[model samples]
Target: MNSPGVKIHHLDGIKILDLFAGPGGLDVAAHFLGFKSIGIEWDRNACETRYAAGLPTIHADVSVMRESRFAEIPSTVDVLAGGPPCQSFSVAGNGKGRRALETVKKFIHRLVDGEDEARIDEDLRALDDPRTALVLEPLRWLLKAIDTEGRDPYKVIVLEQVPAALPLWEVYAKLLRGGEGRLKGVKYEAECWQLKTEQFGVPQTRTRAVLVARRPGHGAIAPLKATHFPFDLHRGKRNVAQAEMFPAEPATPGGKQRWLSMAEALESASSLENSPVDVSRLRRNGRMEFFVVSNYGSGGDPKNRGQRLSSEPAFTVTGKVSRNKVYKSMAEYEADTSERFTIHESGVLQTFPHNFPWSGNDQAQQVGNAVPPRLGMHVLSWALRGSPPSDDELVAAATWPNTPRTTTAELRDIGCGDQSQCPPGSHKVTRSRRKPAP
Candidate 1:
């Protein structure tokens, strides 16, 4: 049977440098799969989160990092992975409109060479950078630099972002070809696919565009295959070809995807006690309110009730937050029960395992901003099949830490003493455990 986790034998020792690494979700997964990882993140909170998780991190803006510094990167880097900030390309953001497009170009230029000198020069000459054209000049610069140095340092490059980035792929493909006859036999080919996280065994449905590029002479790289759940297929949903499905097993027969509920993501706890939650406000919402806790739900048609959902895979987490509304009688005051989804739940849904810690708001803005670690691991395992090791390899190569050995009461007691302690939905204790008489 196919295992839910990536097979370790496929990924023994690999090294990765994560650029624009927000909160280390991708780095954490690479670590779990036995690859070494070095993260570059500009955000203070994200850098701190990575450090706390025991991962090596660089706190400088990737735009400012010198090209010569790229040489400083370990020689054994097998993969270069990152999710550049995509606000300029996101549908919800102003990127689609004119003003935002300028921001996008500027962002790309900055990514290539810390300063927007080219755009600044253009503005001085033409008064404005055209808004409609996709800006990919920086990527061209980086690729050319790598080729000129005769350093094919990385075997593979995984660039992940919103679906709108499809246009940028063409620009990169041409750049890799390098000035016609100048670099003969140095060819590059790439493939892109729109992937749904839930299709890969996550509970939520999130679709993202993944672009994978390989240098000339490397073997074929396979796109990740979905392990469909039986429940989802019974409702007439799409299924992987029978030939591709993993063999059946006792826990998951017929390669069915595993199902996890919001409760499971929340550690299946009964209540959010001693977490300083406002109980009076919670009680005011009616009986159903107890069961109507905030969770990662579907964004599909509200009218389609019978559609089978695959809870085994997670959905592509986005930056949009959920707004909850409650209906009441004409005589009573209506309550806007729209509490933001907690950051912890969002992190769990993104497949960051139970112990990953996040610091910031308990809203979608923070959680959705993260790359699901489980999905990242799936991709890294594929890339690191054969590569040398580095310091970051220690983390990428480690397995999930052993589960906590403490009991519920002991955990609660520890949490009660510390105000900002315990996972969400856990309670606190008033007294310590009594010692037995000798």
Candidate 2:
């Protein structure tokens, strides 16, 4: 792909504040897009990761922080972006969703109140236990506060969440547009878009709902266009030569289809490292026994490696990956043991460049929960570019860097500290030692 002339400083000196800045995914993208950014996150580990990446961050609960405190932030932040926690809205969380919505509402109220301690506290108490409505509520208040101060500090507010939050978009839309919500005077119109991560160059097929709002007077900016190929065999436009697909049109106004495959998302690169398992040990372990002699593809032999599907994008990454199971074809599985997606690999899939360090589990839940950094980068690019690029322009943009291949032996020998630790039974091999000279 050729580099486009679009510059990162689309807004030229705009400032951004990211809430719920998990591991700096959005913040890193924002910086690359040329916005001066400050991230607010409550998780210590996430904060550390952000800090280590050299991104400025504020560690605090959005619920407790007063709106006046936001004044402590720049008076003219050009953009406010974040994805509030969506557990309450999730099907697993059930009816508690209302309470969660309320928590978001309260948080918006406080932000609008300019951090009035009394009001903030009252809003907090108003929320029922096991509820988190305070989260979205304060942002409502913050938006209004920004407007009332006569500084159109935030040109855009991007709210990203799981599909369950679709219903709440109208609620936020109303609140921002100065309708039936407590946040008055913050008149804005919102455009909602849903995207599968693969559509944005992420290997995983994770889908997220995004709401983009701008103050009423600003000329309308269309919803962001998808940049990655869709998983569907039939739908949208197809690139016959590249063999890329686009997402199908939404079945309903707000619904979308499944994700993409791994091979389709990544470009081919030489294998840099290998971490072969002890076949005997794997056979002994019931969990991995099947993999010992499993066929990965048309390449039937257990000894010969299989190949990854280069034409398709990857499956959604998760934290609960089983040692023996495979997401792609068996032939693809035999190609490389490390090819079974790891957390680091998943991170890369999310568009987090190699430089961003992640700490914690190497499992499915963690991987699945992460926002694809590439998607984040794309959003940041939109915010920075001020205008959306044409479909042709977006397609012409650069894909992420390829993963450098290396052998586990080479990695360990070079002392690359962040290298994936060897799995069970693969003790570090050492040359025989000579008898000590007497």
Candidate 3:
């Protein structure tokens, strides 16, 4: 019953301004829920992707945002949604917490206390990774929205980033508090949760530190609880809590958190026409099943890449996901031409609309960097506990513009940025519907 089309909550006409909005994942979610929104992004490819997807966009650097940025928008915005460039603070990146975080905090506290704005500018220039300072830009705008003329108290605030940035959010919650007691009465209370996308029915596993702040008047924003569970490769290999199972129709009854597996997720999109793929003789839900080909080794070699069973959630689909080998096991074992996941398959793994017009040049980076739109739906649902969208709308949003589709043939023999380092059989596809995966 918990299908993609089954909207559990409605945004209820909220206006959203998505900063650093990569490829408009939040915009897609907002549009599906009927929320009025605009996205500002610096990436040209991502902006084109947004435009092609039929979402409104302002292609500009978020750091230079002036008070007049949102002046022309007809309605007052209800939510301030942002995900600043997180690379500088990502644990995966070498720049994690390299003194810039402390500087960022100092800037945030000062800005919250209404200090000399010029000093903050000076500190930004001195930071290690100036990109990290972009995180503070939201606070700058929040301060302006509150102190300057003609702005209303933002009804909600939503933000996300790597887990390393949790401390920044904690400070943000304090600043967001309406005086002191959020339990009693507050304009908004901010809280962050470490969320796993796999737990939200995404075939791939991705964790994001999420923040949601909501003002008084409506019910408190509910903490996002996982709606699905991590699927097990070997059914009896591990005993997981019933709560961790994905709830299915009949097969697994009683609220089991049956996580979607990669095979099931991509089954509809599988095609072995031009490329060689050894489809396993196994069958699930009336379709041929094939094990994923991967470089992952169970021996725990940190240097070597790892693999995930088609029956289990995928590893984090990075910008290099295409380069991650996805093979058809050779019969009971398979692998001649190393199979690669098409852009559409990779995008769907991130829970973007299956046919989302990825109208950009760097398709891999666009899909990898994007906020999974399904994750967006889950987060917003928790933030707005209201009427859900009609199943039709959800389906529409997931499959809209049905063009520039990626196909099995196109993904064959693609090339990565550095062709020499590109994965075997590397293939590339342009954004939009020249081909389709599903």
Query: TM-score: which candidate is best?
Result: 3
Poorest stretch of ten by lDDT in candidate 2: 1-10
- What C-alpha lDDT, on a 0 to 100 scale, does residue 92 get in candidate 2? 38
Q: Write the per-residue lDDT of candidate 2 for residues 183-287, one digit (tens) a residue.
A: 545466776767777766566556777777776665665767664446554323334412334343445554443344443233211121231112222222232
Query: How far does residue 403 in candidate 1 sit from its true spot (Å)?
Result: 15
Ordered list by lDDT, greatest first = 3, 2, 1
Off by over 4 Å in 3: 1-14, 67-70, 178-186, 231-256, 268-288, 291-303, 330-336, 386-396, 401-438
Candidate 1 structure, TM-score to reference: 0.60
- The digit string of per-residue lDDT tens for model 1 on 1-438 reads 223232222222437777777777777777766667776665655654554555555555564443334554445565667776766566645555234444445554444443545655455344243322323423533454455565563556777766676556544545444423323344555566666665544445566667666665766666665553332333343464222243323244435444443333443222333322222332334421222322224345444312211122233455543432222222232343333434454565666654454553333555677776755766666555533223254233222343232322232222122423222333334588889999
Instruction: Show model 1 residue runs off by greater than 4 Å.
Output: 1-14, 97-150, 170-185, 229-254, 258-261, 267-316, 319-340, 360-364, 386-438
Q: If candidate 2 were superposed on the true structure by all CA atoms, what would the RMSD be?
A: 12.5
Worst 10 residues of 3 by lDDT: 408-417
- Please count the clashing residue pairs in each candidate, in the order shown: 22, 56, 27
